[model samples]
Target: MSRQVSKKAIRDSKRTFGNQIIFWMFKILYIIYYMLV
Candidate 1:
């Protein structure tokens, strides 16, 4: 039971991290696009 909980926690953290990375990437791209235009 503990192992399953840990695994779920790890998966959740990894997903949030991936989302954060994608969010930042889009934010940077948007800033650059605005600057260019």
Candidate 2:
């Protein structure tokens, strides 16, 4: 039971990390677009 809980926590963290990376990528793209405009 404890192992399953830990695995779930790890999975959640990985998903959040991936989302954070994607968010930053979009932010950078937006900035570049603003600069171009």
Candidate 3:
């Protein structure tokens, strides 16, 4: 049971990390565009 819970938590964290990377990538692009403009 504990192993299952830990596995789920790891999966959730991996998803969260992916989302954060995508979010930051967009944010960086926006900043660059704003600076160029």
lDDT score for residue 27 of model 2: 100
**1-37 in candidate 1: lDDT tens per residue?**
9999999999999999999999999999999999999
Best by TM-score: 3
For model 2, state the Cα shift of residue 14 in Å: 0.5
Residue 34 alpha-carbon offset, candidate 2, angstroms: 0.5
- Candidate 3 C-alpha RMSD relative to the actual structure: 0.3
Location of the lowest summed lDDT over 10 successive residues in candidate 2:
1-10
Per residue, candidate 2 scores C-alpha lDDT tens digits across 1-37 of: 9999999999999999999999999999999999999
How accurate locally, in lDDT, is each candidate?
1.00, 1.00, 1.00
Shift in Å, residue 3, candidate 1: 1.1
lDDT of 3 by residue, 1-37 (tens): 9999999999999999999999999999999999999
- Kindly report which residue stretches of model 1 are placed more than 4 angstroms away from their true locations once superposed: none
Badly placed stretches (over 4 Å) of model 3 are none
Q: Which pairs clash in the backbone of model 2?
A: none
